[model samples]
Target: MRSDPLIAVEHVSREVTDSTGTLTILHDIDVALPARQSTAIVGASGSGKSTLLAIIAGLDRPTRGTVRLDGVDLFALDEDARAAVRAQRLGFVFQSFQLLGHLSALENVMLPLELLGRGDARARATEMLGRVGLGARLHHHPRTLSGGEQQRVALARAFVVEPQVLLADEPTGSLDHATGETVMALMFEMNREAGTTLLLVTHDRGIAARCDRQLHIEAGRLKPAA
Candidate 1:
């Protein structure tokens, strides 16, 4: 594992069996994401972009292949260890903005830090919310916020811990162009500031173009963008 390569995915494949027989989602995917550099995984729906993100993030396991993050072999770790690694080294943003409707913005942002028993969880959450221009809305619940505001809250929550790698899956998929651009700008800015490696999953060409490198996936195969 290189110090600068925060994430390495080698010969990764994921398969599942349904009544229709075996279906392969990703095949022999190889990627090396360098620290502080932005990388995009672009593909159509069912092209396995989100699946790859999940495997790399340690949220899902591949039937075959290895994922190493910051010198830790994600699959080598047991369930609890993998969870710990994710807690300490990874941050994730999703297309759906998976926030708790019952929790306020501040509480949503504080969840990870509090789980880690960090003493500054509340202060850190408040600062992150403020950084995302949502300081005034910290007490607002998800249902009360607009789509863009909810996404901003998700962004705040993702960056609250300053993890080594940031994984975003269609982060701007729900916003209009202007709002999406603003959200992406904030993401890139925070990545730069924190020196976090960025691995983004998106269908938007504009977003892919802004990354340091682009990868294209089609029918379970991974290839460098043309």
Candidate 2:
């Protein structure tokens, strides 16, 4: 069975003004990302891939057009309401691991569930950590763990929510090749098992190939069907 798209981007563009004047970061972009599938955005530096992802995740606004999440117009909502929708529907994993140095692996994973008032936060987080092979390191802080361990904890936190959408930005960029491969494999496995829609921005073609489809970008424009 085919599910309706979880996200729809329609003619979106972004521009920023600096001392050098206005710079166009993204041209008009349109795409539909179906639920429970993974799509990768690949491009060179300054290609606006991350910008597009941020816009889709409602972290950034477009100068033109709008994005819809599960048929709800993102820009149509007020900031707080949009934030609420984003928090409820989306999860993220980043190259930097983005974990708190002060929080242990289990605590970091439990934070999101706690934010949502889930009483089973500790139990769910513990299970997720075990799933990612981090059960023994549950009490280790990000600074105390290796890079791969931190990323695994990040993956656990991301999947713990079973979010409707997962957005990853260069998730392997900061790791060694061997560790990167392991993390990516685990991320795919988690995404698949949770039936979450994934939108990843990556520079590596191999990583892009892991996705269900690839959207190629060049000069701030998407190349059709890559």
Candidate 3:
């Protein structure tokens, strides 16, 4: 069965002003993200891929246009409201593996569940860590884990919420090729099993090919890659 699109970006544009002048980062972008499918955004540096992803994911607002996620207009929501929506329906994995350095792997995953006021957070977190093949490393802090392991922990924390939408920014940006492939495969497998909509910004061609659709950014414009 086909499900409704989890995210929609319509004529979105982003611009920033610095001491030098105004810089247009993304120009007139449009895309649809259907549930249970993966889509990748690819481009070189300064292509505005990450900027567009940030706008679509509600981490940053667009200079113009609209973003709808799970039927909610993101721009209409206040910051706090948007945060609430994120907590309830969105999950994110970033290139930097933004885990708390002091928190154990399991505790990191449990944090999101706690935000949702869901009990059994520890149990669910442990299960998520195991799913990421980090069963024995659950008690380790982010600094103690390998780069790949930290990313996996980030993935676990994101998926622990079973979010309706998952946004990843260059998920494998820092890993070696083999480790990157492993982590990417795990991401796809979990997304498939959970039927979560995925929107990933990546420079890796192999990663892009695995997605259901591809959107490429060039000169601040979004286009279907030839």
Candidate 4:
């Protein structure tokens, strides 16, 4: 991992208004994740872990403060510009394995590359599917694959772009224990091989333990991990 931080969060906070009143979902948070390192964000349900992840990924905006990804101030850009940066530099893996059910594995993996206008989209997608051990299942739809297989396809699609950072939210939350373990193992293996910085939000202590560092959040404040 490089000495420089790949992601920087400075004095960040978030709030939402409900019928009751304004509620703070995150407090003044400061975090720095080094390049090519793995960090886990751990907290209980509704502790703002997911909220933080979304802000980091540029999927949502924080009410206050700034987020810099590889020296680029994310919120400084307009939505379209931010999206372009995300497509080029970030990969996301969701717990639910968000694949288009109507598309085959190959097609699903090809979508991003296609959107980016890569001429060799088919070849790259095919190669990625093979890496995830889904070479033979390229034509299979998500519904036909096992949960592990579906997640593997999701992994392939995420890494196919060779993103600088990989962000995951409860990646194994929906799987059985054994399958979740297997998927996580593959995730780490691929992370190592690709030298991608990994920032994952997970409630599982075992998963958090595998990361280089763990950030514990409680009541929207970043706390030292127990």
The alpha-carbon RMSD values of the candidates against the true structure, listed in the order shown, are: 1.6, 1.1, 1.3, 1.1
Model 2 ranges off by over 4 Å: 1-3
Residue 110 in candidate 4, Cα distance off native in Å: 0.4
Which number leads on TM-score? 4
Going through the candidates in the order shown, the clash numbers are 0, 0, 0, 0
After superposition, the stretches of candidate 1 with alpha carbons farther than 4 Å from their true spots are: 1-4
TM-score of each: 0.95, 0.97, 0.96, 0.98
What TM-score should be assigned to candidate 3? 0.96
Clashing pairs in 2: none
How accurate locally is residue 24 in candidate 1, as Cα lDDT from 0 to 100? 94
Global lDDT of each candidate: 0.90, 0.92, 0.91, 0.95
Instruction: Provide the lDDT at 108 for model 1.
Output: 98
Model 2 residue 39 distance off true place after TM-score fit, in angstroms: 0.5
What are the clashing pairs of model 4? none
Candidate 4's C-alpha runs over 4 A off are 1-3
Clashes of 2: 0
lDDT of 1 at 61: 94
Query: 1-226 in candidate 2: lDDT tens per residue?
Result: 6666779899998999989899888888988888888999999988999899899988999999999998999999888988888778899999899998999999999999998889999999999999999989999999999999999999999888889999999999999999999999999988888889999999999999889999999988989882
Better of 3 and 4 by lDDT: 4
Top candidate on lDDT is 4
Return the TM-score for candidate 4, rounded to 2 decimals.
0.98
lDDT of 1 at 54: 94
